[model samples]
Target: MTRVSDPSAPRIAIVGATGAVGNTLIDLIEKRGFRYRDIHLVASARSAGTELNVDGESHPVRAVDEFDFSTVDLAFFSAGTEASRQWVPRATAAGAVVIDNTIAYRMDPDTPLVVPQVNAHELDRRPRSGVIANPNCSTIPLVRLLKGVEQRWGVRQAVVSTYQAASGLGHPGIDELKDASRAALDHPDETYPAKEFTPSLAFNVIPKIDRFLDSGFTLEEQKMLQESRKILGLPHLDVTTTCVRVPVVNGHSEAVWIETHGVVDRTELVEVLAGLPEVTVHDRESRHAFPTPATVDDPDRVHVGRVRVNPNNPRAFWLWLVADNLTIGAALNAIQIAEELVERRTL
Candidate 1:
């Protein structure tokens, strides 16, 4: 891959441009002020012909089947695993770097699963196959916090239980929550209407995110463990995860417990986390100070709070973190990867 010396020379394409992540990417691109020679938005045939107004210009959404990837320098895909499975090769073979927000290529040895704050150095070497996988939404914030702790004190074990938002499933998930909430008000004794995978999400939490394996862990839970190991370069890192779907519409929350190799004092740990870019430390004695799904505002940073060291184990610590799943977890991260490539002249 040859580096593009001029930052404004690279033409960009956002595949799946009508979906949740794609829309968020468009919003953040405007907010972050990235200059590109040209921008293309491609989606499925059903979403084609839709006009998206960005940077004061209306760009018509084109069908991916008709759009050519050869002229594009970078592509961000979030359609789904199946679409990515079929199109990523074409994008790479045409010389465009693909930052995929799907599970399709994440575990592929040739593809680097990345969370920028945790392992931006992985971007130094462009993928030989011209593809990089964005870590899972829940995994993104979890790993972001762990990176600081792991660097200051080696990580031995990590336990995370996620309170994932409906948005993780896409716009349909959001719609389901809204419809269910309205239905629940009159039919409190009956199950609310559900067309999505969830049966009832308005007033309840489902202990499942993705399909369960024989080992009983959902795919979402396993992604956190496996992706964390790959990004942190910890092959045997002990990680236990439980992923659940909650009624919230945007942000994702996590209750985390970590055991490090050395004892890191509470004050020092707070300072270290605060020093990391895009991470906010808000631990306080009052419960009101702790982070919740509603507490997440900026789409770029991870909010952390409720820090405490285990009384019996000096090496163990617990905390809560929240982040905008659609923004920082998906779109912002994919954009950051593309930005990193441009900054390093690897585009």
Candidate 2:
């Protein structure tokens, strides 16, 4: 790593700096005024030489192959899984700790899969692998709420269905959706060729998010279960999910059914959810109570509503949540991990 005069404010590099999450990271860094000695933008060769502004300064994007990871103390990798698999080791080997925002190292024994609000303790010490893994976007919000419920009532099992937006696949997915939707409107009979989403996400919802496993669950679904278990330290946590791709452009929504060991009270449940850091809960009283992706005022927070206890079973409750997949699910989580590392002097 480059010798830093101020350890608290380390030089940082953003791999995949031209992608959706990378852009969100830049915006958050500016909005939150995250301190850093230097910032480097790195992306694929195709995006190299392009300029993107961060905190009012224009930074030319450098090709990842040409970027020197040794010049930075920390690197945030929001590139796809394959890119992360190929480059994360190089960054870590160069002595820069990596906050990987992909599924690549989440299950690795030495790399801690982190959701800052739920498992900031994991950042107290740097990992043996020299990398920290950001949990799945859908998994991030779920685990954040699960941590609170588990602590108060002891979770039994969680069943979730995610309404993920096109942005989960980044700009290409968004572009495809917009193109397909326009085509459908103009030519209702013709089919739009969809590369990002199967059967087109124009006016339909696809039940699968990622590749299907032998057991029939999509990889996205499995990520939620496995990542949740790892982050919450509940090795046998029974969290099953159905990951769906919806037509929306940005935020991801989840309908969660949580069965806890103890009886749950609605008022206290609302209080617990609302009390969590950066979470907003909408109770049943208001005229426009529940939060939707487009309607939610605060993008940084996890918005939850429709809290209902199963009448027959007091231990079971259901809730709906909306979170910005690019921010809360990706960029913000990675930034939070870095912030925790900085605060704990673990980097």
Best by TM-score: 2
Residue 76, candidate 2: C-alpha displacement in angstroms? 0.3
Q: Against the true structure, what is each candidate's TM-score?
A: 0.95, 0.97
Q: Where's the lowest-lDDT run of ten residues in candidate 1? A: 1-10
Across 1-347, the per-residue lDDT of candidate 1 in tens digits comes to 12234556688899988889999988878887776778899999999999997787889999888889998989999999999999889999998999999999898898899887778888998898789999899889888888888888989999999999999988988988988998899788988658774668988899998898999998988989999899988899988999988889889999999999998799898889888888888773343477777755666889989898998999999998999999878999998888888888788
For residue 249, what is the lDDT in candidate 1? Answer: 88
How far does residue 207 in candidate 2 sit from its true spot (Å)? 0.3
> What local distance difference test score does each model get?
0.87, 0.93
Per-model clash counts, in order, read 0, 0
| Residue-by-residue lDDT tens digits, candidate 2, 1-347 | 22235657989999989999999999889887788889999999999999998877788999999889999999999989999999999999999999999989999999999988888999999899999999999999999999999999999999999999999999999999999999999999999988999989999999999899999999999999999999999999999999999999999999999999999998888889899999999764652489999999888999999899999999999999999999999999988888899899998
lDDT for model 1: 0.87
